[model samples]
Target: MTSAGSAKKVVVLDYGFGNVRSAERALARAGADVEITRDYDTAMNADGLLVPGVGAFAACMEGLRAARGDWIVGRRLSGGRPVMGICVGMQILFAHGVEHGVASEGLDEWPGTVEPLKADIVPHMGWNTVEAPADSELFRGLDADERYYFVHSYAVHDWSLETANPAMRAPRVTWATHGAPFVAAVENGALWATQFHPEKSGDAGAHLLKNWIGTL
Candidate 1:
């Protein structure tokens, strides 16, 4: 978080795909001057960066590597600048993609892979709840049981590393499986990611974004 009186600019990566509009709007409301670009210079110059997407892991990674123009991703993350990836955008932050046998290098924010949700329901959509981490600045104004919208068929499942919190009043926020518990959100340095869509999450999501922006 950058603190008050220094609302830094946020560059939302637009690789000709993903949910750019809603994200732009959300960031804008949070007081960040949003710029949707693939240019490395612009990304590097921006105070923070956001990558939002809705698609398969294989294709998303291909687009990122191609439009990497300046490899802005690695540049910013390495430089210690705050960066965030949402949904599929977050999935690409890992080392590889198990979807369709695709293998790619992740930003390595956390050690893991993005695997599909084994839920009877294919694409997990609609308003799902999100539990806030007890001590995360990201969960500052959020309650222990908060509702954040989610839509995905895959997730990061690693109980030891999985950061599980429940959505308010939701009994089944955690999907225990044969293997382990998956992660719903993760944070390392100034970077954070969610398997849900905060931009479309309405009020709770907006506050979460605002809190994140405040940190920058």
Candidate 2:
């Protein structure tokens, strides 16, 4: 066990778009040494970085650039150190977004784009269930009925293609459509993300946050 003062430190990037307070509180409750900072150097030094975002893609991207730029966080995600993104923060991990008729580039940590949810509704609210990806470390303690909080009009349509044969497969990317489809997913490598607010989803959310911290 880690000594009290020797606990792992985590930095939550406050890029001015997401629910900063809720993330900080969640991290703290999960026993991370948390610091809410917009300073690039400070954010880069932590064991883990959590980016929680809300609002438009272009606006959030601008805030991250103005606050910490792209390279710093981008490099860390690429390095495979633990990095978590909630809601639109997760969406921005993809290659881009075509919201409001403007194609805004994402941080490119993941291979996908953020497109508006169509058919059912825009900005899916309340609690919705998510099935765990068959092979995922992020779903360690989460169950099938577990629901997370979501409030967004856009969702990810992954551009990464799946080949019939794992060894001979060249990935082809696809976009998520505006209709009834997958609600949430965890893909790529060590990175994990959600289109919902686990911080607002009671014990289920708490368990996810705790699971994420344990990974750190």
Candidate 3:
């Protein structure tokens, strides 16, 4: 349990991924005592762990595996610990990532595939709105039309998780589309992921981050 008076400790995993400093700053703004570290204990014992990523799917997966990030994320989630993934970080949580005719394995925390967004545009950059479900804690306090920053070509265009565990609520899936529909966010038990970068998403992003910190 945490309070406004007591800062929550969060680790922004540094596994040769995305912008750690920006992520740290965002979490700090959300009242978290954030650290950019790969220390085993620090990562596993933190109140929450944020996995951020940018660039190609296979390349990010390569870096993540080099640091055993998949294992760390899995271990934490299995114990009911909180974990969030952003951008390519979110993509790696699925089954496989197919890019440039190459398929790369992922964490498989959820059942799905990450492929290029089917649009005339490659990277779906800039601020975009999401239709988050009414019951989503990650989107709590966020308006239906609130916009968040996005920067990517690859994403989970098709969602595969429709049912929840016996004791858990149904997975709250959010969607945003470019040329086709894609998974923008997901909330399943202890695992939370966002295809959009809350760090770069202004006030809407801050609210989302705060909502996640509240769960910690």
Candidate 4:
């Protein structure tokens, strides 16, 4: 465990998308020594890495590639380092994202497709509750009725990755619904992701961030 004087160092990847400044501030408040940068070495060396994303999946991927953020995430995960993704940052972790009928490739860290919500409303914005698993460290100590902020149209409606080896632990999946249920969060090994913006989710969000920071 790190000493109180040495807070966990976290990097909010500034890959030209998402609410970078807001994420940095939130992580700082969560007791992390936070830096917002696209520097490969700095990001790789951080105690935790947060990938924040906004806008379309294709555009986010484009920018991420330009900054080599994808490489950083892959390398970090290969070594069992902690990495987190928020909003579209979470979406792009999947294999593909189908937005407006255009299928774009994602990081492929997880096998899934991000498609538009089937709800009458296109973008499932605002606060909503999620069904997190009992063993979820991210949602630890949070109430079942606790809500988080979400602002997006596209999401992974189904989770298809099943653990091939019985001895290996399966990925913990969290679910939330609009017109239909979709993946709200995922904790798989070193990779963690949330479709909602914890930075925008008020006190519950703050608690969630603290939970993630604690894991770091």
Candidate 5:
């Protein structure tokens, strides 16, 4: 068993995005030596990085851009470091986000768009089970009926990811539905993201965070 002394050092990025302190606390509980910082160097050098966000995609992107969050993420990923994105932090990694007819550009790391959920209700709030892929390490040992917390109106509807590496393993993309199916979590190499707020998901969330830290 891995010891706490060997636990990964994780940095929760604070680019003025929402729920950072909670994320730091969650990662710490997950056995990571957590630090909450906006310092680019500290973020880039950490064994793992956590990016948490809330609110509109455009507002989150504005904050990310102002702090050059993309650069830090890109550089770390290029070096094979680990990074996990939560909620809008995950949303802004896509190509675009259309909220109220306003289309704002995203990080373009994935080929997709974030739009309103086609549900009877506006925001899909509460706990929901996710359908994870067979090869998923993030959901390892998690119960098949495990549920995560979610509170959002917008989500990525498209599930296509364009990659040229023919030998690459199929990216693990978890899905959950409100009115229609939407991305719940994605584990793609060095980049891992969850549309649900794992920090707010309680015990199940703690297990998920631990799983991600295991990868680091």
Candidate 6:
């Protein structure tokens, strides 16, 4: 953990697919010393690592692997280091993402499939509210009515990961609805993710980012 009064060092992994600059600005505003880089050493050494993504799931995964970001995330989680994903970044953490009738394998950190939302209107764009769990660290102190920015057509509609061990804490899953309910966010151990762009979500997003940074 960073010392009190010192900014946490956060790396926004630049693997050719995310809103890198936007995320950097937001994290900086949230009190972290942010760096935008794909350097393996720099990313692993940072107090917090954030993965941001936009566009197709397959393309993001391809870029991420080419940059060895998949290795970085897996390694970080092995040591219980903090890692967060935004937008399509969150999508690729699942087992598979089927976009445009093609299935691309994901990081599989969480078991599930990211499929197109069964919505009347595709790309559930604009602001929406989420049903955050009471014990969620990411949503801590935020109002229940607070909304976040979302711009995606694909989402994980079901969560299949369950704690096999009775003593282990279950993952905290947050939900939002378009034409139907889909995962909005998830918090499991050192790994955290959100389907919505907290960076673009305004004050509520800032608060959520601050909450994650505080834990770093």
What is the C-alpha lDDT profile of model 5 across 64-161, one tens digit per residue?
98888989988988888888899999999899999999999998888999999989997899999999987899999898899999989999977898
- Which of 4 and 6 is the better model by lDDT? 6
User: What digit string (tens of lDDT, one per residue) describes model 4 on residues 1-216?
Assistant: 346668999999998999999998888888899999999999999989999999999999999999999999999999999999999999999999998899999999999999999899978989999999999999999999999999999899999987999998899999999999999999998899999999999888889999998988
Deviation (Å) of 135 in candidate 5: 1.3
Q: Which candidate has the highest TM-score of all?
A: 6
Backbone clash count, each prediction separately: 11, 8, 0, 0, 0, 0
TM-score attained by model 4: 0.97
Sort order, TM-score high to low: 6, 4, 3, 5, 2, 1
Candidates in order, TM-scores: namely 0.84, 0.85, 0.96, 0.97, 0.95, 0.98
Kindly list the per-residue Cα lDDT of model 3 for residues 117-156, writing each as its tens digit: 8999878898888988888889988888888999998888
Clashing pairs in 6: none
lDDT of 1 by residue, 57-155 (tens): 877877887898227777787787888888888788776568756565665656677786767776777876555555666668776667778777778
Candidate 1: RMSD over Cα atoms? 6.0
Predicted candidate 6 versus true structure: per-residue lDDT over 52-160, tens digit per residue: 9999999999999999999999999999999999999999999999988999999999999999998999889999999999999999999999999999999999998
Tens-digit lDDT track for model 2 on 55-114? Answer: 898898988888864766777776766677888887887788888878999887665777
In order, the Cα lDDT scores of the candidates are: 0.73, 0.72, 0.90, 0.94, 0.90, 0.96
> How would you order the candidates by lDDT, starting with the best?
6, 4, 3, 5, 1, 2
Q: Which 10 successive residues of model 3 have the least lDDT summed?
A: 159-168
On the 0 to 100 scale, the lDDT of residue 115 in model 2 is 79
Error of 2 at 48 (Å): 0.8
